[model samples]
Target: MIIVPASADTERGRPGTTQQFADMQAYNDQMLRAGVFVDGQGLHPTSRGARVTWADGEWSVTDGPFAEAKELIAGFTIIEVSSREEAIEWLKKWPASCAPDPGQHLELRQVYAPEDFGEEFTAELREREEQMREEAARAAARG
Candidate 1:
């Protein structure tokens, strides 16, 4: 997962230019051609979203815009690559104009596969997980 955090300009609800979006689309196309792009999406600003938090054995919903811009995610990209280095190489090609100014950063996090959990993750569990994923894909396709 490539986590795009909200920048200062993003927190202010600044929108990307048409050219920037075109550039980003081109970048995404390139990644798709390279067979590394699994899925990706850009997000609207924090003002249009909400957060749900659990505290003191209860749940609370808070409306945006959230005060901590840096802690908020603006978007995400999921890539399928053989190595971390390959993923970083793809990240390096991110379109500069597509993101906000002043400060911008993307975080990389590895998604855990069932194998990563070792023997405790039983074969039945793995099979069930795979089935669930297949069902989800089918549902999405139907939609």
Candidate 2:
């Protein structure tokens, strides 16, 4: 399974507070019931954020109250699904509400697991991971 996190554009997201919250709650409940949701959240406006960079043993921090809507991430979700098609199917229902404008976009990406590292280290890592999971399952059953 892969987990994907997505966000809406700051400029074109939910416009009505009461209706939006209701719609979002309903959508979240549906996904949770279907066991497709791993975790998710909405974010505060961009003005409450900051940016930092590090290079060559030095660090720089910028005060953001970001000026651009495109620089902000409005919300995110982690979903478990079988394939990219399935992931897109899930994403198609996102935003949970109609956008105030037409430019909203959701970014989809696959979460990396040990197996994505390829045959070299992945083979051994996957075996170890399976063993760990089995052990954890046995421990949970005992408890």
TM-score against native, each model: 0.88, 0.67
35-109 per-residue lDDT for model 1 (tens digits): 988898877888888889999999999888888776888788899999999999988998987654456578899
- Evaluate all candidate structures by whole-model CA lDDT and list the values in order: 0.84, 0.65
Superposition TM-score, candidate 1 onto the true structure = 0.88
What is the per-residue lDDT of model 2 for residues 19-126, given as tens digits with 9 covering 90 to 100? Answer: 777886777788899888887777655555678889889998887556665535666678887788988887677545633334646678778877677777666778
Cα RMSD for candidates in order: 1.8, 5.9
Runs in model 2 lying further than 4 Å from the true structure: 1-16, 95-100, 118-143
TM-score of 2: 0.67
